[model samples]
Target: MKKIYILILSLILLSSCKEKLTEEQIIVNQNKKTIDSLTYIRHNLHPEYLKSDNSELVANEIIKNCFSVLEIDRKNLEAVKDLAHFNFEIKNYKEAVHYYTILIDLKDDLNNRYVTFYYFQRGLAKFHLQDFNGAIQDLQQYKNENTDKRTIGYSKACYYLGTCYKNINDQSNACDNFRTYAENVATDEAWNLVAGYCN
Candidate 1:
């Protein structure tokens, strides 16, 4: 009986060591990826470094870090979302898309409103990149989900949808959307976009 007890204790110790090793490996890998991302971003933004072609490298590192951190600490959705936005600011649209996609996927898991804002932000980026199909897709998704009738989101969606239609020469649809935006927002920017583009 004593020998059997000792055997069980040995097995427990072995399993614990394996778990610790796995956790340590994960931590080390995440740190390395994060360091790589930070270094890439710094070089890209540094005035003296001017000629780096590391956008793909930086994007990969950020996506890896964001995904790994998310697996461990999903409560850090805000941090992950911000990192995604940082990608967008640098015109790293693919990276931005990846991050936002993950963020939206984890919305129920994180129980956060991040996806709402990202919907709009990603829409704008897609629009500027002339991914008109993608822009319309995201904008329409946002408009469908956002039920805040008293806020500005509804109106912005209308304006963006109008812009998307106008870009594609769907003037009739553009006019309808512009009318909706003008009715809801009444802001200078929204009004100007409508006036300049709509017939």
Candidate 2:
């Protein structure tokens, strides 16, 4: 249905711009529309949205669209990121890790300040997958690059690091990270973690 819609739209556009635009330009315009549609769906979907009966259908469409976008350009950053985040949101941690790896490989094409959180996000995904050592490496890099210790990003990283460490029986590191989280977040839950384990 979407393919037909796009084809019709492309034909209309191509006909209207026949003298002014080339075939490749028309195709690019069509691709942009597809990507915009995908972005809209991705942004509008809440975590709870998955409870709907159509949720799996919508998710499958998005996954298919993401792969279609990637087929056009493997290094297409937005497509790769959307796919990575989509998988992560659905709790498909392994696929999230795979796509995040591709995103990380594109770091040279990204702004340093903007892309730093990719590490933190991928670390969390790895943590969910129980890849504790990989999560530690990514989260540690995120911590090093993200100098603002007061932000939620740092606090969350500390929290996850503590859990990952605890999972691996590294009590000392776990306590230290929990203490850091408690200091920065100051949430009751964070303090409880510190008290329950660090103290």
Candidate 3:
């Protein structure tokens, strides 16, 4: 009985030690994976390498890898922004909306000019996703804050806002936004939209 007790106690000690080692190893492995992923992105998705023929493929891979990392660490804003931008660039509007939504909620600093840009991009994503009301809200928010009417962003926002309003049967608001867009951008498309929708 004494020998059996000693063996059991020793087994328990070894088990506890193994558990501790396993926990430490898990953390170390996670850190190593993060480092490896960041390094891979730096090499494969850098601006210099992005001009290559395989840039789109490389960007898709990076987005996949970044999403995995983001799953482990959702608060990584860089990963979130990268996912949002890459998805937008690839015209994966659904994924762009997902990441931008996450980024908007997680982002701490919203006082800069970039805040309007984020709203505009997210609005466009929502527009592509067919969430017209949500798109209107986001685009309107951006329009309210962005004072530079000469910017391409402002024109796009107005155009999309008009589109969103028209889709939702808000013809009055649609006409108003279409007029604003036409006033800011003297393009044939803008004028045609204003004529067709605003009249």
Ten-residue segment with the worst summed lDDT in candidate 2?
41-50
What CA RMSD would you report for each candidate?
6.7, 9.9, 4.2
Task: Supply the TM-score for candidate 2.
Answer: 0.76
Instruction: Give the per-residue lDDT of model 3 (tens digit) for 7-28.
Output: 9999999999999999999987
Best by TM-score: 2
Better of 1 and 3 by lDDT: 3
Model 3, poorest ten-residue lDDT window? 103-112
Sequence-dependent TM-score of model 3:
0.75
Model 1 lDDT vs. the true structure? 0.73
Report clash pairs, candidate 2: none
lDDT of 1 by residue, 96-164 (tens): 777788777787875546577778777877887888778888888887778785568878787788889
TM-score to true structure, per model: 0.60, 0.76, 0.75
